[model samples]
Target chain A: MMVDQFVAQIRRLGHGVIDAVMRLGFAARFFMALILASGTGLRRFSLVVREIYFAGFMSLIIISVSGLFVGMVLGLQGYNTLQRFGSESALGVLVALSLLRELGPVVAALLFASRAGTAMTAEIGLMKSTEQLVAMDMMAVNPLARVIAPKFWAGVLSMPLLAAIFSAVGIFGGYLIGVRFIGVDAGTFWSQMQAQVSVRTDILYGVYKSFVFGVVVTAIALFEGFDAPATAEGVSRATTRTVVISSLAILVLDFVLTAFMLGGN
Target chain B: MERSTYDLWVGLFVVAGLVALLALAFKAGNLGASSIGSSYVVKANFDDVGGLKVRAPVKASGVVVGRVTSIRFDPVRYQAQVTMKIGDAYRFPRDTTASILTSGLLGDQYVGLDAGGDSVMLKNGDTIHLTQSAIVIEKLIGQFLFNKASGGGKSPSSSTAKAGGL
Candidate 1:
């Protein structure tokens, strides 16, 4: 009896650990399939194109508006510091560089997570809980391709455009702060950035980071939904976990991607 | 719910808009590449160049006019020959000076130019008569450390006594 009890305790712990991991794997797979399915089954150029338009381009206004304020804050801080060295004119570099490489993608991803990400998780969770998944099955619908496809495709396709809008708005925001609030010359602000501001890598990294972020977020949201518990209680935990996990994952992944791209070569 | 054709046009516009935006960005980025500059050869007699690479920005009035196109040892002069590219707009007179400048607190280094009054402007392939070689921060820091070891820990601010007024 003692030996049996000991074995049971170890087995229970192992099962608990495996269950947590399975939940995570399910989420990752769900996101990946969304991307894969776009290219594979639901592969209408027009449809994917439409999905991209709605997902990526439509989200531009929200991202840019948020990004502009971020730029303003960076400019305010950068100006104070750069003023000490008499490099105030180069506030463009400070604002532009920070906005393009770091602030734009991370901030937009967080906002997108809040706006669409939570809703996606909940929708998926509700569907799974009510077994609407079974009704789709009986109707000969591919659940992965139909409903999940739109969200997944939207997240992946929308990122780069959102990032670009974010960067443009952010720089403009910085310009406002630099010119009106502080007395940096508008010409000097622009020329300084023009002189030392740009590189292909900066733009490339922004676009690339956005694409990766889109994949990660959709996957997390879908995973939580499909993996929802049979009971109302289980579904609640899944939704909460989706938000917490995805937001944190985006931040961590952003840093890792930044380091690899900038620091590697 | 049935969606109409008008909803589809909005989708088309979004894709077109993003493509246009990306193209514009790539075009602007090309304007700032290091390769955009004029070429001028400058023979600097450095015992060591301290790893100055080719295509590095050469500046005048903090504006990049050219780059270091080549760096080779002139065995004949026993000095490092650094060929620089100054932009066409910048006419370096016969006695113009060249030195490697650190752009900021960071080690982002570039070459600087100071024009001197000379009747003749330098043509391509003419080596700059006056040249101040690269200043490595590591060497400067090492010198400071050596000074500290010998003189017993004076604050570094004392060394900047000669560098008066911003």
Candidate 2:
């Protein structure tokens, strides 16, 4: 009797978890479709550009510092091992691949989500609290256009550029740590990095992942913001939820994509 | 405030340009060396590969002169065999030592050659005779931790060194 009951409880718990995941996935898809299909939203071009600069440029310090440290760690650890086999010269190639394929986009996206996602959620939530969305609706203007599109485009535009900056600067960080500190041959390191690289597909994969992250992050922010009640407390709740959900969604999506791409891993 | 169509176009162009530039930079870096001097190809056998992968740089005396082209496990020998392509200019003496070496501490692994003293130079298809295996840092660290744990709180300088003491 006890074993049968335990099995039933476990099955119920598993079903509940699966149902929750499906609901989140369905919501994300619907939200993504809505944002993509809205055309006049793109007409708010200046707003998008400004938001891009604001979110990405303002957050450059955090990205650079993080890039520097990861690069340093890679260099330090890579140098010690390569020293044993006496192939320390190829540090640049290793560093470049690490930054380009993995670290750059993931870190940039996380940083961008923290900064921009929270802001978007708060702005939309505030509009809800003050009933400005209702006012815009009565004026025959789309609130989604006035609010969500700019945030969405900002996320999409900034992420790729931010990833690029992280990739470039990250190589320099590796160079400083690996070549200068660890006594790897700087010239050979650069030479290998230049010579042997994966195809355009590798970089394209990163950019595509950034685009996916943008959509996921913006959708979570918009949904949470729009769902918030017409109160200051509700706005705060929306802001918190948006940040948490967007960050989690970014990681979950990243894991899913990574598993799909690197199948059998 | 609405950005004009022209502004959007400019922004698009700038973004496209940056993307193109980054792609070109990476492309030129990767393809240039291979196109210039890809010549001799040879294979080396290893007991373990560690983190070595295809396209990793192969170096002689800390200078990159080649790259690993392929990796395959030899079922018969129960070992990983790495095939490498060296520049035409980099001819090794017959007694050269080839080792699977990593780039840096956290970097990827590559094949490294230590040129040896032999009168006859190695040819295009000759196999390198001597090979050192890959050294993984995590494994070494694990060994160290295990040694400290098991040595009854005594220093394991003697036993630890004998147990792949790297």
Candidate 3:
């Protein structure tokens, strides 16, 4: 009986692996469909604009607020630590580098995944459950072109910009705490940051990271929703999966990108 | 929301993002004051460069005049060859001395140029003579430790004089 149970468990595990691989393959094909159908989506630019408004503008308040708080915390913590080493002036360098290189892209993407990504999954999943996608197919209207491609493009366009805004606000918050409140030399703070941070390496790399995250997060969210079972429970589960899977993907991609970008120097 | 309203908001969002990117580039990065344009390159050789890295600011009397463009090791001379690009806005004499200096005790290293009294300005491709290598802190500390261990039996004043020579 024990041997039989062990064999059954092994089979179950293999089944799970196969299921995941099949889902991943399906997602890839869906992504390729999105790209191919993007021409039609772009032709009706209003759809993309509406999606951008929802995905980008709607999330701005939370991103800015969280960015400010994160920066203020970084400033406070960095000041206390750097003061011990008598390098309080270098606080600007620390704050800017951390925010621009790591925190901005990663945190903003995480926020985007939770807020915008979940909404994308839920909306699409609901439409799928209601047979809207099938209805569109019956009418010879491709939902991939009409619905999914627009959302995907909006995500790809908005993420880097959102991440930029987050970093910029975070830097201001750091300046407020470090220079204005803590009395670190204002000149040294700005000058040192400018001197240390290269536009190409630090800022451009951050933008590139966000762009990749946008594509990944949007793809996963849409894929989960589109592939979700036609039930309320399935849509809800897919929404949750969008958040969990995208967050994990963001972090793993961040590590790989950072190593690839900075390992040379 | 109406279609027009969506378009307006999207427009505003894109503009805001662009503005933020510009602020980051100008304020927090070296975009506004980058001196890589129309620059003249000069080479300097050092026995040791320590922590001096490529793209480090090359300052003349505390003002940044150029950047270190490249650092290469010369197997022939067993020295580090540093190429610096100086902005054409500033001119330094041919006899200028390039010495690597640190900002604070633990700060990043930079090349300091002390212009010598020379009538001729340094042109592109000129090798700067009288270059001082970066002070390796480990060697200094090790020497100090070695001095103390060796001179433990001698008078303390003698060791003090020897240490001062460094």
Candidate 4:
């Protein structure tokens, strides 16, 4: 009996692994379809505009405020540490490098996942639960093209912009703290930053990172929503899952991309 | 008309993003500004460059006059060959001294130039003759420790004076 039970458990585990692999394959296929359909969907320009308004413009205040605060904290901490070595003029380099290299993309992505990703998931989950997707199918319309594609592209396009704004505001915040509060020489702070940070290596790579993060976060949100059970409770659960999954995915992908992009340098 | 309004907003958003990107490139990377004027190439050789890197600022009396364009090893001489691109506005004498220096206590390395009293000005492709290598802190500390151990608690300054005389 014991032997039979152990064999059954092993079989179940194998099946579970296969099931997960199949689900991942399905997700990849769906993502490709979304990309393919986006070209035609772009012709429906109004829909994309509306989605961009909702996804991009709506999140600006939060991103800006958080970026400023984060920069101030970096300046304060960096000043204290650099003061120990009497190299406090390097505060700008420290703040700019930290934000451009790591913090800007990761923090903006996490915020995007929490704020907009959850909203997208919840909206789609509600539409699914209310059978609106079925109505579109019956009317011979592709819901993926009409509904999901615009939002996905909007998120993808908005991420880099948001991250840039975040870094810009953060730099201003750093200047206020480092120069005004800490009495670091303003010229040194700015010049040192310009001398050290590279356009191709630091800023452009940050944009690339945010772009990848945007796609991953939006895809997870939409996928979770579409796959949710057709119930009110399911919609809420899907929204929560979107935030949790997208946050984890953003961090993991950041690590992988950083290792690939920055390992040698 | 509504679509036009939306398109306008999108355009504005795109412009904002571009502006932010330009600001970052200007403030952090010093792009576009470098090309405002032409620069000429000059070379220097050093025994040790320490942490000096390509694109490090080349300063003359604390003002940036150029940038280090490349760093290569001269296998024959066992020295570092540094190429610099200096702005056309500044002219230096042929006997000018080039020294590798750190910005602060713990900071990035840069090339510092000291103007010489020579009447002949340096042109493009001229190699600087007098060059001082970077002071590596670890090497200095090691040397100090070695001297201290050998001298059996004698003053470090006395040993340093003797070594300099030698």
Candidate 5:
């Protein structure tokens, strides 16, 4: 009887792994379909523009405010730490590098996942639950092309832009705290930042990371919604999954990409 | 909201994002300062580069005129070969001296160019002969200690001769 129980446990684990692999395969196919259908949405440019308005413009205030606060805190903390070493002038380098290389892209993408990604999931999940997708199919209109692709494109387009704004505002906030409040020399602050931060490596790599994050976050959100079960509870679960899954994916991908970019040296 | 209003707002949003990126590139980065258009490359060799890195500023007097493009080790000569891209606007004589210099007490290292009296200007790919290697602080301290141990009576010129012998 004990051996039979052990065999049952092993079988359960194998089934769980197989289920995960199948779902991943399904997600890949869904992603391919979304890409193939994207041209239809692009042809009607207004669809993409409208989605951009919802996904990008609507999230600006939160992204900017959080960016500023994060930068200010970095400045205060960096100043305190660097002061001990008598290298307070290096505060600018610390703030700028952290924000540009890591915080700006990662935090902005996380926020994007929570704010806009959940909304996209909920909207699509609701449409699916209410049978709007089935109705579109009945009328020979592809819901993926009409509804999902525009949002995918908008999310992709907005992410790098949002991350850029976040870094820029964060730098300003750091300046306010470091140079204005803390009385570190303003010339040294700006000059040190310029001296240390390279455009190709730091800023451009950050933008690239944000762009990849946008694609990942949006795809996961859409996939979760599209794959939701046709019920209210299912829609809610998918919405929550959109936030959780995308956030985890963003973090994991960030690690992988950073290792590839910076770990060689 | 009106459709047109959405379009207008999205346009502004995109413009703002682009502006922010431009600000990052120019203000926070070395983009504006590094725009040394139409430059010529010059090479220099040194015994040691220390912590000097590629893209470090190549300054004439105190003003930056160019940037270090690359650094390579020549196994045959047991030296470091540094290539710099200098702007065509600032012409240096062929006999210009390139020395690695550190800024402030504990700051970044850069290449300092001391122009020599030569009518001929350095052209592209010309190797600078009068190059000074980076001063390692530990080596300087060791030399100081050695000088003190010897008898505190040695002239500075003799110290220089010993250093050159190394």
Candidate 6:
């Protein structure tokens, strides 16, 4: 009986892995369909514009405020460390590099996932539970093209822009702390940063990372919402899942992208 | 919001994002501003590059005049060959010495040009013959410890003196 139970547990674990793989496959197909349907959806440019405002504009305040705080903290920490070595002038380089290279994209993506991504998931999941999706299907309208495609594109386009704003605000915050407060030479702060950070290497790659993150986060949120069981509890669970899954995915993908983009450099 | 109002706001948002990106590229990344002015290329050979990287500033008298464009290994001499692009407005003497220098006790490395009293100015494709490699801290510390051990507990300054003599 013990031997049989052991076999049963092993079989259950195997089935669990297979189930996850199938779900992943389904998600991939769903994402591809959304992408293909987006061209048709693009004709309704108004819908996309509205979605962009909802996702991008709505998140600007949080992105800017968080960016400023993060940058100020970096400046404070960088100043304290560099002061010990009499290299306080390098504060600009420290702050700019930290923001452009790592913190900017990762932090902004996390914020986007939590704020915009969870909202998208909940909205779509509620629509599913309320049978609005069924109504659309019965009316012979493609829900993928009408509903998901615009949101998918909007999220994808907003990410890089949000990341840029974050980095820019963060730099300004650093300048305030490092130069205005700590008395590091203003010229040195700007010049050192200009000399060190590369447009292609640091900034563009960061934008690219955010772009990928945007697509991943939006896709996950939409997929979870679409797959959610048509119940109130299911919609709530899906919203929570969107946040948790997108956050984990962002961190994991950040590591992979960093290894590929920055390891050699 | 009305369609036109929404469009205007979205347009403003995109413009702001682009402006921020441009600021980052120009102010921080030093993008197209480099190529906007005329510049010339000069090469220098170093025994070691240490932490020197492409785009590291090439400074003269603590003022940036150019940037390191590329670095490659010279297999024949087993030295690192660094190519720099100096802006045309700030010409240096032909006999200028280029050295890899750290900005502080622990900081990024940059190419520092010490202009010599030569009458002729360096032009494009000119090679900087006098070049010093980066000072590796680990090698210096190892040398110091070796001297101290061999000197049988001598003062640190004395050990430095003996090491300098070696």
Candidate lDDT values, in order: 0.70, 0.73, 0.93, 0.87, 0.93, 0.89
Q: Lowest summed-lDDT stretch of 10 residues in model 5 chain A? A: A256-265
The weakest ten consecutive residues by lDDT in model 6 chain A span A191-200
Interface RMSD of 6: 1.3
Best by DockQ: 3
**Where does model 2 exceed 4 Å of error?**
A1-33, B1-166
Question: lDDT score of model 3?
Answer: 0.93
Residue A195 shift from truth in candidate 4, angstroms: 1.7
lDDT by residue (tens digit), candidate 1, A1-265: 9999999999999999998898668766766666666554356444555545545555656776788888899889999998888788778878877876787778888776765676677888888778887789789977777667766777676666666677777887888899888989987677556545445567667778877887887678777777778668877787787778889999999989988997864
Per-residue alpha-carbon lDDT of candidate 5 for residues A25-100, written as tens digits (9 for 90 to 100)? 9999999999999999999988999999999999899999999999999999999999887778788899999999
**Interface residue Cα RMSD of candidate 1 after superposition:** 4.3
Clashes of each: 7, 10, 0, 0, 0, 0
- TM-scores of chain A across the candidates, in order, are 0.85, 0.82, 0.98, 0.95, 0.98, 0.97
Q: How close is candidate 6 to the true structure, as a TM-score?
A: 0.89
Q: How close to the true structure is residue B120 of candidate 5, measured as C-alpha lDDT?
A: 100
Alpha-carbon shift of residue B16 in model 4 (angstroms): 3.2
Whichever of 4 and 5 has more lDDT, that candidate is 5
Instruction: Using lDDT, rank the candidates from best to worst.
Output: 5, 3, 6, 4, 2, 1
Please provide, for model 5 over B1-166, each residue's C-alpha lDDT reduced to its tens digit, 9 standing for 90 to 100: 7889989999999999999999999999999989999999999999999999989999998899999999999999999999999999999999999999877546788999999999999999999999998988888778878877898875554555454332
lDDT of 4 by residue, A64-128 (tens): 89999999999999999988877787789999999987888999999999888988998888888
Give candidate 3's error at residue B86 in angstroms.
0.9
Which residue pairs show collisions in model 5? Answer: none
Q: What is candidate 1's lDDT per residue for B7-120, written digit by digit as tens? A: 465466455447534542543233445555444555545545665666566778866677776788999988887877666777878788877656544434566789999999
DockQ metric for all predictions: 0.22, 0.13, 0.77, 0.53, 0.75, 0.62
lDDT at A173 for candidate 5? 94
